[model samples]
Target chain A: MSALIEVKNLTLKFRTDEGLVTAVDDVSFTIDKGQVMGLVGESGSGKSVTAKALMHLNAKNAVYSPESKITLHTENGPVDVLSLKTARELKVVRGGAISMIFQEPMASFAPAITIGDQMVEQLQLHGDLSKAKAKAISVEMLDRVGISDPARRFDQYAFELSGGMRQRAMIAMALSTKPKLLIADEPTTALDVTIQAQVIDLMKDLVTEFHMGIIFITHDLGVIAQTADKVAVKYLGRIVEEGPVREVIRNPKHPYTQGLLAALPKLDDLDAPLTPVAGDIPSPLERPSGCVFHTRCPKIIGDVCKSKLPHDTQVDGSHRVACHLHTEVPA
Target chain B: MSETLIKARDLSVGFKIGSGFFGKSILKAVDHVDIDIEKGSFFGLVGESGSGKTTLGRALLKAVPITGGTAHYADGEVDYDLTTLAGPELKDYRKRAQLIFQDPYAALSPRMTVRDIIAEPLEVMGLTKTREETDARVREIAAKCRLNLEHLRRFPHAFSGGQRQRISIARALVSGPKFVVADESVAALDVSIQADVLNLLKELQRDLKITFLFISHDLSVVAHTCDHLAVMYLGRLVESAPTREVFKAPRHPYTKALFSAIPSLDPDDRGSAQKLEGEIPSPTNQPPGCKFHTRCPFVVDRCKVEEPVLEHPGDGHEVACHRWRELADTLAA
Candidate 1:
């Protein structure tokens, strides 16, 4: 299959009062058409920042490196995302071709306006559609998302809906535009397990039906395992491991990935002790000199880990890991 | 047999809602429930959003009022009836029972230093006579919680989520509580950090001999840490049993569904879980009969009209489902 989007050396940093905090450093990945790429990381790992960079949605204080390039392969041609400056020029990538769903569904929707109006407005903004046509498609998307009484729910405010229903409405709104790419940022984190199950099922079904590429960003590796075709394990703004979901999860190469997998409480083995990744994640301002994960890495090798960054080394056909253990000596 | 630290029979906690004298309605957050927590055991209470697990934890700590039924707390020295214990006896019970909140950021005061936050409890309870004594107690508990003594001088803002939680744990344990209620204490932290906190709690429970009523929605975490487990649905206990027993063979349909809902780490195990349809019903407008019947896949005519009572099905397992036996037989067949 052809690549839908290609990101090369996408480095981003925010100008804070303290200093320039590098949120996304030398990150690169690709998502094929109708494929889902999972970005798994803890807070401040720059997964969300990388996703936001795809649509040029970062704040004004954000700065991108000269080498950073994001090329969106549209039907017409490849569009450079970073080069787009004005809102009009960025419109094609923003909600036109790419749509985002936040963690909190309640905060995503307007409290005063009805759910139907917002969805209809989004549809109209993306393409040329009449008020009647927009409303018709909006209600259909709502019903398609498993919301009961779609017509009645369309007229109700966001506050009237429950947490699960509000999330369904948010999904419906995001999909109403029927964009080519969907960026779901911790969409199921706020939901309960049962409700989260429902949402995950809905997303999987939608992916099959729409055949759209998805960048699923979340901290839950379990959710990522279920939804993603390929997985990228990020830590401290860098991709520590990247490979097919099964390969990375089953045969992890990086110490950070292994630590993450070990930390999770597995239902199959209740007797196993939960061994956490040692030490706390360093503050973004203190960004480690060489390998960002060197502080907490249990499988540290020689002085190279502390002084020099390890380049991504191929473990198998598609599996790649950036760790001192995976790298070969220069001898 | 292990001693019972907390025993509740038909314990209920109801809050009156609405404003006017005429316009008043009771919201029974904790309905009629029976539970016995063995001393020195990590007992877990699992449920969804409106399952009343938090309310039950609070009622046991005497943080909320018990509108009906009875609850007893026994630790060999003092056995206080939680429902009626007031005045001096109630004041004494406060020190013996404490709570660890879910959000460490919200739970800790921004203005107070770690030392002051942990020492606040001892100072209020008068557990320590002098400033030196309070400092000593704070330092000792802080050390036990794996908090740095130098960091205690810094404000809560200086610490990360995991570190802040350690401070919260130190504050809760400062009073030397026998029975502690950890209500989603590790839920807010990342998975890697969550394990550290869980290990800390388990270690502390062993070292201090504290009986923890661990409340969380995540079954996987509870499976490894908690010895006994209770599943609640809409303010009612649907099932209660040993953790291994519940995981091996869950009797209640709700419990089975909960186990299946947890996303497996294996990518190939997709869509295998029996996903429950519909959201949890509002607490104010709860349905009659079985609270879980509205979302249950095996709802019968009787389940729609008549509620099931807790029944002992052997091996110390308790289930409140009428068709559990028949369902088990069918599964076996």
Candidate 2:
């Protein structure tokens, strides 16, 4: 279980018009080689921000804490991602070791350039490969990702392809460089169910072949259950629970995790009513004083849940929960 | 069992594509679709993008021009042919039917307050007499949607995605529409909030007795929320059945493939999905025979030449597949 990337004490805030809004607070997680870590969260949960922080891809308004650290291990050595200031120094972390695919492939791809051109450009930038070699590598990657007629598809622009193909092309482009870590932030969210399944299968096959660590971020518990080896449930910019995917999904320790699972419309039980988390997720500007999830936590014990933030309590060997109900022992 | 609130026979919506004389062609977005929405039933229409599920829903609502076929809107009290509906009847139909848009962020106007947003529909439809009457209706509907009266004064920018979606729902329901078309209404929402909105919609259906034409690509959500289901592919209704029957014994290949494609919550259930190959064909240039023959696994020579009409094998489960009879036998085994 050799770690590929390690993030610790990651506290991020954005300089907004209202005030400094905390996006990711004291969030720490790790991904190992050939493992998939699912970061599950809703809109304001800061899952995307945490993934962006891994590659130092946060917006200009983002301000990281002094104690924040992201360590990425490569063949060369362990590099501190935060310390890499210059673009030249950061290239090692950017596309060489870390590649990301977004929710919308169309937004990520350039309208004018063909999908092949983008892949070739990425390959040449990261590796000392000739133009012809780059083209061949791009075509092979496209074919590997299940794109039909790779040579003809190589000449087609992003707009020329359908939604599924565009997504496959994006996946093809990301894996062409053979990065050690792939951060796919809601990669299948924009796609249809059938296409989503296909993409998920492709990703699983890629993981087994490439043996690369993947950070799969999505709010979908089903997707997490199918794809992820480990799961981390985030709420209001903090990890409320973490455990093995099966354990976390089957027996979620945190109230937020339990609420999320209960909220899902299960196909197995069509008669069961969907039970949503009690209250709405509070605004970031007016964040709660203690636990961020206290407002919505159905298992809130007492004033302690509303007054003091609970520390992470280990439930089992690998399962851990951050809720006052689990952490505090009332006499 | 109940009275049919909306009925359509071979309804088609065609849009003229291309500009030049020779290049001009009619893109039949909704092609020869037959559907029935029983009163007080949640009917789910499921399909991938470009499948024309949205267009079919819109055509039913009279939001789009129906180029062919006939549709009827009979809520027991009022009976009107949706196709030839004009002038006062069309205006009256607008009050009876409404659409809930998918994206809450783009649906609501940022300039308008929540109160005005909900009230706009009522005022435009001339449902209320005065501002006092409009405010009363808005407050009533907003409260039903779990929106606070204080929150009504705030602009759309101040609310979250879930809150904005509630506002959208309140606006849609404020007009007191008997038939509502919710097109991917909860697709943009998170799973947690999505459940809340879905529950709200279900509650609204039971309390208000509104027939919802719920259009979405999510099979799991549709399975739980809807009483009846229709699967569309390439602008054609491939299968229509009771929700339980559709889940229990799906006759159509596309429908069965759709069910398998939904990612299971159990980790052990890996990629055993019946993966469908090839993309949905473009509506502009559909295949010669069955539109789905290109991707159909059991496709044969006959499927490529002659289109299969919707056939009821038994129990009112209509399936549009040339080989469904054989497929059902195999599925049974």
Candidate 3:
């Protein structure tokens, strides 16, 4: 499969009033065509920051490392995302080749504008389409996403629709641009379970039909298990473990990943105790010295975990984990 | 059986919506709900948004006005009728029951220190007399909730989501309430922190012997934490049973669909569970019969015309569905 996008040594920090807080530290990953890469992490795990770095969507206070690089392969050629400074130059990476859906559908949409108008505006901005054609395409996309009476819903405001319907509308709008890569940041977190299931099914279908690469970012391990082919578990600002979904979930290598899996309330075995990762995630300002997860690691291997960062050890053909438990110790 | 702490029969909470007089309509947020909470039981109430789970919780707490039916609070010492409860009786009930809000960030005041937030409830109820007494009470509850005594002087803004939630829990339990209504208390926290909070709640419930009414939308969470579970849809109680019983064999279609929709952790188990179609109907313009008829996969003709009452087939499992028995047999076949 052809590579859709590649991120290398991408370290991001925010210039805050107190100090420079590192958000994403040397995070690197690649998305292949039609593959779903699930970025799993807790609130401060930097999953969202890594997703935003792909589209250059972070705030003005954000700073990127000098060695950071993002290359998006398009029909034309390989486009360097960070090098594209101007809005005109960045358009190809924005809604043109990459589209994003947010957790809160209401916040993403304009209160005053109709759903149809917003969708058509997006399509027209990205491609050369007439107003009539864009409107037709938007309605078609809405119908495709399983919104009943799509034509009627096109004219309705975002508030007029239910939470489920609004989410479906947002998905339709995002896909209307026909982008190669879709970045869904907690898209189903706001919806009910039934609605979330429907949205997940729709996204899976869209992936196959359009053959588009998707970066699904969420704190929900269940959602990640269902939707993603590959999973990257993040802690603090580092990718602690990266592997095939089945391998990572069934047999997690990193202590942090194991803690997360153990923490989830399992259905098959309700008697299994919910073991939460020990201690609160330290503030980003006072990041741990060696491994980011060592402070809370259950199986601490002597003083090595506290002093030096562990290198990524290949577990299998496709699986990789960065933890002292997996890495070889020099005699 | 253990002592019934709170008992409700056809308890309903209604609110007037729309405009003045003629244009106004009553929105029944909690309708004809029957519940019995035994002392020291962690009872769970689960439903989607707009399903009146929160309304039912608040109604039981007397936070919302109970418009119809009867609710009794009997904790051996005080047996007061909740519907007609007022004056000193109501004031006393405030000390007996408390609510832990859902959003920890928004629930705690940004300006108030952790100590003051937890101490406010004690002072309001006049549980402690001297300043030292209030401080002593606050410190004890804070320690029970697993909060740092040093951090009690710091404002809420300095703490994380998990710590703030603990502060809220401490505040709710400071008055030494026998009953606590934790309304989606851990929904806002991350998964790792969510487990931590849930464990803390379970520990507190066991230690203090507090009858907890845990309200949440997440089924797996309720499954693990609660002893008894009640499933709600559009202000109606569809099913109520022990946690294990409900998970092992869910009778109501809505309950089954809710369990199915959780997105299994096993990747190989995808799409095996039945998915409910369509969104929940608007409460204002609800269907005439069963509220779940619109989305239920096993919905029959009888479901659209007449609402089914709760029926006990055996054990403590209560289900409200016309074809639950037949559906159960057929699924087994």
Global lDDT of each model? Answer: 0.93, 0.92, 0.92
Cα TM-score of candidate 1: 0.97
- TM-score for each of the candidates: 0.97, 0.97, 0.98
Residue-wise C-alpha lDDT for candidate 1, range A26-128, written one tens digit per residue: 9999999999999998877999999999999999999999999999999989999999989999989988889999999999998999999999888888899
lDDT of 3 by residue, A1-331 (tens): 9999999999999999999999999898999999999999888889988998999999999999999999999999999999889999989989889999999999999999999999998899888999999999999999999999999999999999999999989989988988999999999998888899999999999999999999999989999999999999999999999999999999999989988888898888899889998999988999998998889889999799999999888999789999988787557
DockQ of 2: 0.85
Q: If you assessed candidate 1 against the hidden native complex, which CAPRI class would it receive? A: high
Share of native interface contacts recovered by each model:
0.84, 0.86, 0.80
| DockQ for the candidates, in order | 0.86, 0.85, 0.84
The window of 10 residues in a row where model 3 chain A has the poorest summed lDDT is: A322-331
Off by over 4 Å in 3: A329-331, B20-22, B330-333
Q: Write candidate 2's Cα lDDT for B73-156 as tens digits.
A: 999889999999999999999989999999999999999999999999888888999889899899999999999989999999
Q: What share of the true interface contacts does candidate 3 keep?
A: 0.80
